[model samples]
Target: MPVENSRIKGLYKQTVQERLKLVAKAAGLTDEHVQALSNHGELDDVAADRMIENVIGTMSLPVGVATNFVIDGKHYLVPFCLEESSVVAAASNMAKRCLGHGGFTTNNDEPVMIGQIQLLDVEDFEQATTNILQAKHELITFCNDVPSRMIALGGGCKDLEVRRLNTHMGSMLVVHLLVDCRDAMGANAVNTMAERVASRLEALTGG
Candidate 1:
């Protein structure tokens, strides 16, 4: 569903709790979500340690609001967390200056990424390259066959490319898998696909 207008005047003047309530109501957020945001000390030592390596204490940064942003015909009050002064003010000033020209427009392509697999110690580079090219469809299908929620969401391997590289050690072959990850970052998905196809690639290249 499309978002309604975000032009909430005097939002920055309100207290933290009042601003949270207003934002929750405007965004159709549940009471539980609002309560979570309102609560302090939410991230204790245990939670902080679990989130990253080493059991160090948590750090804090000042979060300020930058107002008067109209992006794509929708107004916004962007929250910025930083230690430097005048950053938020500068951004708000720039955004207000651009409002007369339909604000900022953004364009993004499909979220596709490349996964590379390197093959070394090949006996015959020419024949191995030919074999991999011949089995391109099978390799792509193999990558898509893995149990991934991304594939169910209309995202998976899209194309394959092979390149031959000459290193100081010897000749090496690299296979590139082009995958569309939809809304995900796709690091895990791409790495898993590369790992799954490694053995088959070894057999084909006699690596």
Candidate 2:
């Protein structure tokens, strides 16, 4: 569900509970989501420790509503959760100013990211490039061999490319792994794949 009108006048003048209610209504938030947002620092010490190392504790930031935004003919009341002051008010004011100019428009391309595997100390650039290209299918298959949920959902390594970059240090081979991460950010998957396939790439390119 979309927000009907983002131009909520005097939204900052309201209390925290009032603003939360308004955000819940405009953003079509569920009861569980609303409860989680209302409850600050829901992440316990154990949970925070599991997330990262040296986890002293968890912290909470104030979430403010940046009102008056219309993008692609849709009204939106964006929420900003950070320590920086004046960001929410500034964004809200700017978004309101763009209301008369048809708001903001967008033309986004397909979501796809690349993982580069740099091969240093190569003997022959041409031979390495040829070798990698010839084994592109096998390399892609190897990268996708993992039992990843993303791969199961038809999102994984789609193609492979080999480039010979002539840096100031020397000429090295760079293998570009074309991966379709789908809905996820693809960092975890891409990083894992890169680390896993480094040995194989080295054997292929004699790096």
Candidate 3:
């Protein structure tokens, strides 16, 4: 009710700096606040240009703040740094409407990626393919044996596939390994596993 009361009383109608001042006052920083305001008010283009990239001069734009956000059941004051008009107002209105039903829910899947290793220079492509197929279990075990700490955290090589490709370089068999990385971005892990598997596969084929 306190939040609703603050909204109804126009306390939420103030700008961000004004609200910050109110917060500082509530936190008993009223006496030192004048110095803070004076310091901020003295900011000029020379310092801003040094801090920002390609800031030749000051650009005039209307700054607005949006309120009433509920993302994943948590309330938030969404800030939009833009010069575009009506975007913030529209987004805020939509967020308010969605809050009546329920807040927005976001979900992310486990990061999994596939890497391909192309093997060439083999005497018998068919036999090489068969050899890799038979060694599939060992390959998987080898991947798990290295005990990739990243893979251990909800990540590991899961499946393997063989592909036959006919390029100008001649026919080659490409091996694809699918890795599941629980919470990580997984790019580096997938790439490392792919390289390791490729080396082992080359050795198996006596390449």
Candidate 4:
């Protein structure tokens, strides 16, 4: 009779094959893992290129997780993936030095982004800018019309600025919209809003 080991917590008994399968599944590995497994036996000219994408080939980088970090007395293991030589070793040494003198502390600035709308071929530049400024309430309302949950967390458009400059293509005004993006990389959102605003500005300025 075979025994089944299914402990719910902490430690459980599993065969080597069972553990490997569990790890492979948990890691969300693709067919690449299968090929790597197949390549355990070295062969001359083993061409296994059917299992990956953009396979000019894959590159390897050394990854390290540093321990002994305490934030408000809570321990953390911060992992870093880097390919630079000796970076991992240097980080390990620095972390060791900081552990005894209280763990490292860090704070981040709120990720805010700026969107620019260039208004060219204006009828009356000053009046156009004034019109935009007078309609600030409406403009801000329109700018905050983002459809993402991250952007909708009261972090859409904050303010708008107008910059007048002279160029070879005549005098142009660049409208700058500052946006606060809570946790997302907001480049796409910023650019999209900028383009929309540019179109609206062109309509207003007869461009």
The model with the greatest lDDT is: 2
Model 3 superposed RMSD (Cα): 7.8
Which residue pairs clash in candidate 4? Answer: none
Task: Extract clashing residue pairs from model 2.
Answer: none
Task: Report the lDDT tens digits of candidate 1 across residue range 44-120.
Answer: 53443333321112234344445557766776656564456667657767876787777777779989999999998
Q: Give the whole-model CA lDDT for all candidates, comma-separated.
A: 0.72, 0.77, 0.61, 0.57
* Top model number, TM-score: 2
Better of 2 and 3 by TM-score: 2
Each model's TM-score, in the order given? 0.68, 0.72, 0.56, 0.57
Output the TM-score of candidate 3: 0.56
134, model 3: CA deviation in Å? 1.9
> Model 2: per-residue lDDT, tens digit, 12-119?
655556666777877888998777765657655344333332222224655566778899999987766555667776787898899999999999665567899999
RMSD of each: 7.6, 8.0, 7.8, 10.5
Model 4, span 157-190: residue lDDT tens: 7789887889887888888898887887888878
